[model samples]
Target: MSAEKTPGISAIDTTNFARQIVLDFEFAPVPKQRQRRGLRNEIIEVGAVKLDYHGNVMGEFSQFVQTEYTEGVAYPVRELTGISAVDTAMAGPLYVVIKRLSDWIGRYSAQVVCWSGADRRQLLTECQAKHIDPAAFPTDWADLQTFYTSIMDVGSHGCVSLSDAATWFGIEFDESTGHAHSALADARVTAKLLKQVMDGDYRVSPRAQEIRQRWGGWASEPRRAFPRSAPS
Candidate 1:
């Protein structure tokens, strides 16, 4: 790890971050017919791809999580994620999946990576609601969007989506991941992008200041113990 450190956060070690476990989540919203909902966006899938220090894939984790939604899967969610109610019907509960994921991730001394902050926020919210200890999550993380914008010297508007990022890296989007919403597929793609970024000496460009400002400010170091509860 580099000895260099950013303002309030620990050293912005791209190399170290790339070696960490990259994760993603696919959540299903409660059916619209329900006037009352348990969780706003209930997690239906959890996926992760852990990388070694050289950025090679070391292992992976993927699972369909059962939600408490009695309405079954929403039509739109099924259409978007291709995850039907029946798929999650016999899957393990959210708490159980979370526990298994925690054990898998706890074995490493690496950070977590994702294309955006949405997955982290969702994990925090779900864990909080289920009374699962959020502390098991790795404190360090890298938001690929922010890093990509910086490395490419692109301004905020130039930020690329996951599929776009794959194209930029010259990596084919694997169709086997079960469409774009497949958590494991998405995580795999994110891992590839991480490798590209780590292989270079890219740093967040000064333009990133503007984007960070829009989000309030640069995320606190080690990030916050948890992000604000995910949007309703």
Candidate 2:
């Protein structure tokens, strides 16, 4: 669904910070043998949406990065992200792609928002591997997944997937732009979800509420240890 038709999001407020960036990454799947050889999944795609304080779309950035996988993109990864080896083969190197992304973000004082902490971790790992200065990217990063869980008082220790959270808020994926797993699609959805939370127009599911109540709030109940049985 379009942002205008998204529920729980009202008219722009035109207050708060200057801009916020919603970001997502797609990683190439590493085989078990390669993983054993100290190879980690490399970022194949980067997608982001820049929004104003009022949640209006300012701009977007999307790029694909070539990977070191000589065997070409893994079948599963290609299937999941719809990014083929040909795509990465024709794309720029990781360092080049990241540089372009940093340049696109410019000197604007904007906070980078991602669906979860994993994206930040992945970025750090890749940057370190490429010897690219992480400082090139915005340091002010926020995990929207954590924020959503904490605010909804549900799954605070874990997280709801971006698509699941969107579904909970009656937000539909705009397939015309991209599919569910595509980085851009996910980032766009995340932007919408963030707007809903900021507007305080989202709802916590009844099931989530019931689960929290049964668990005596959002905190997890400690497991009771059974005493060892005496030998008969």
Candidate 3:
């Protein structure tokens, strides 16, 4: 991690800002749309991506979590995420995945971005549900979702979806990058979309500045605890 103090409450070079940040998440299996969403939420794939300034893709971290079903409940994640029973037959347990995620984060620095609190919430809540410590999400991260909202001007609508953001920038949206419900894939896409939306040659400076300015007064951290896994 860089030793620089965060340029809090002011817009420093945003590219520099993003470089200092990291994105966290887990992809809950998205089965067939609204119908299968609940079933797929059982065990999600966890992942994260790091980005450096100048819009460089740095590295990625992730692991698959094998949920331990309740007493009489058998997890049918195969149909939910399209991962067959054979695929998860050999996968390790939930604790192992959480440990891997913790190792990936190492010691946290500030600047973790979530489009909304969704990914952030998933990581923390799921960890808790599994009896894992959730501090892996540090106190230094930034909430781009909230920050984006305050400055976006809210034109009868709002900032685009991550996928929409890609489309808005004329970048091709690859569903394959999504990993169905693999957390790492989701993180990579989010990181890629953020880079595409904020970087040069493709991004508009005024819009980028709008995002940065929206960050003002927004905190670099939150103290609330994540709710445990919701009904799936």
- Highest TM-score model number: 2
Off by over 4 Å in 2: 1-17, 31-39, 153-157, 203-232
Task: Please give each candidate's TM-score.
Answer: 0.73, 0.76, 0.57
Q: Supply the global lDDT for candidate 1.
A: 0.66
Task: Candidate 1: count the clashes.
Answer: 0
Span of ten consecutive residues with least summed lDDT in model 3: 221-230
Error of 1 at 136 (Å): 2.3
Q: Native-vs-model 3 lDDT?
A: 0.47
- Candidate 2 similarity to native, TM-score: 0.76
**Clash-forming residue pairs, model 3:** 38-232, 45-183
Q: Residue 118: error of model 2 in Å?
A: 0.6
Return the candidate ranking by lDDT, descending: 2, 1, 3
- Clashing residue pairs in all predictions, respectively, total 0, 0, 2
> How well is each residue in 4-48 modelled by candidate 3, as lDDT tens digits?
223322222343343434454433443344222133344545566
Q: Report the candidate with higher TM-score, 2 versus 3.
A: 2
| lDDT of each candidate versus the true structure | 0.66, 0.69, 0.47
lDDT score at residue 17, model 2, on the 0-100 scale: 42
Alpha-carbon shift of residue 119 in model 2 (angstroms): 0.8
